[model samples]
Target: MFFASDNSGPVPPQVLAALTEANTGYAMGYGADAEMVEVTKRVREIFEAPEAAVHLVATGTAANVLALATLCQPFETIFCTPTAHIHEDECNAPEFYTGGAKLTLVPGLPGFDDKMTAANLRATIAKEETRGVHGPQRGPVSITQVTERGTIYSLAELQELTTVAKEFNLPVHMDGARFANALVALECSPAEMTWKSGIDALSFGGTKNGLMGVEAVIFFDPKKAWEFELRRKRGGHLFSKHRYLSAQMLAYLTDDLWRDNARKANENCAYLAEGLRRADAPFLHEPQANMIFAALPRATHQRLFEAGAAYHLWDGPLDGDPNEKIAARFVCDWAISRDQMDHFLALIA
Candidate 1:
């Protein structure tokens, strides 16, 4: 049983079928294929924006970095949480792709929950932009749904964050590597969760769900589309035989497969979390999506690992006292089943 990451799971049949169909044709290269054309149409139709510009890349980093670079000048700084994937996980690709635009982490204020509210953001923008050219001017604000901390922002919270950015006349960007997961949890319309919330750009992820690799960069204001295309090419993220990537997304969006996949993964995590809670395990963060971070005794950890159940220990070693407790990071994927989770829980028990 592998609980290391959703990225490790097998792709759905839809994805492989689309890939097979794409392989049989001699399509145009570099995103000019018919499959890509359909993906753009499908994504726009779902987001309810006929005029929206949709572009596809193979990784979430490309989607976030390119979108931010398009929205910000080289001298600007992107504002996000210190725990945002763009800041902590992407190795400064956002900065590198944006020609060195800095990331100004918005430290969560006292009593603030999983999100940076409009007020906290207002205070941050006011404090940071006060430097007057001596420091980085305000660029776009990037919000990570299913935060690295495994918590989600409510629709009201999302709207509030976007409102804060709009007050500063700055565009908003979302690092939605967990877009489907957040959507399933929030149970809101794609438009309501994004554009209607004043989000100007989105990094719509597919890799963490079921696809081999694919992510879409969607811009509500289509005016910024071509510049992002150029930035994507410049960043070397533009796939040459791009139909493979486009086909994956096409299958993912068809018949709401992305949403269903996320729902199943989240359900599996909830099941796992229920089991952990029943065992009185300590949770490190709010288990909102497919990822769960919980602490168990070293004895339980050793028994689980020895039983071939794979996951990552977050805070302590595996070779410690049997009574010592430490946190572990567990990720459930779309393909994981209740039976598998049950088996894993039985191992720990």
Candidate 2:
């Protein structure tokens, strides 16, 4: 049983089939293929933003950095939580892509998953630009849906943070690496979670859900569309064989496959969480979407690891005291079956 990460999961058959279909003939390179056109149209219709500009990249980091570079100036600083992917996981790609724009860490609510409150965001934004030209200026505010800890922000909570950004006239960006997962968890339409909530741009994700590797960067305003295209090319994220990316994304948007995958993943995580509860394992955060952070004894972890069960320990080393509790991360993807989860739970029992 593998529960390390959704990134390790298998691609959906539909996506592979679409890639095969797109591979048959000669197609224009660099996003000129017919598949890309359909992808743009579908994303626009799905988000209800008729004038939105959609572009695809092979990685979520590229999608996020390119989108942020378009919204922020070099002298400005992006606002995000301490645990945000752009801050912790991207290896300063945001700063590098934005030509030296820095990230300002905004404190989240105490004891909750790392989600920035409106008050905290406002305070952080206010603290910046205090020294005029000496300090970094305020730039776009980035919100991570299905936060790094796997807890999701409700529609109202999303709107609240965006509203705070609007107060300062700063554009808002969503690092939606797990966009579909958060969408399915919230039970909201694409528009309600994004533009309607005042998000200026989005990094629409697919790779973690089921696609091979393809993420879309959507600009709701469309005013910065050209700049984003140029930044994407300059950043070397523009794929020459762009239709492959387009094909995967098109297949994801077709037949509600994206939502279905996310639903299955969330359901799998829920089932696993219930089993963990029965095992008397403590949770670091509620299993809201497809990821869980729970505590199990080192001996129990060793047992699972010996059984070839894959996952990550969040606290101390694996060689610690056998009875010592260690928090670990478990991610459920769409491909994992109930039998697999049952097997894992049995090991825990």
What overall lDDT goes with each candidate model? 0.89, 0.94
- Show the colliding residue pairs in model 2: none
- Tens digits of per-residue lDDT for model 2, 24-85: 97999999999999999999999999999999999999999999999999999999999999
Candidate 2: worst-modelled 10 consecutive residues by lDDT? 105-114
State the displacement of the C-alpha of residue 81, model 2, in Å, after optimal TM-score superposition.
0.4
lDDT of 1: 0.89
TM of each candidate vs. truth: 0.97, 0.99
Model 1 agreement with the true structure over 1-349: per-residue lDDT tens digits: 7999998899999899999999995989999999999998988889999999999998888888899999999899898987788888899888888898998878675634346667778887887767686988888998988887678888888888888888889999988888899999988889988999889999998999988999999999999989988888888988999999999999999999999999999999999999999999989887999898899999998888888898999998888788999899999999988888889988877
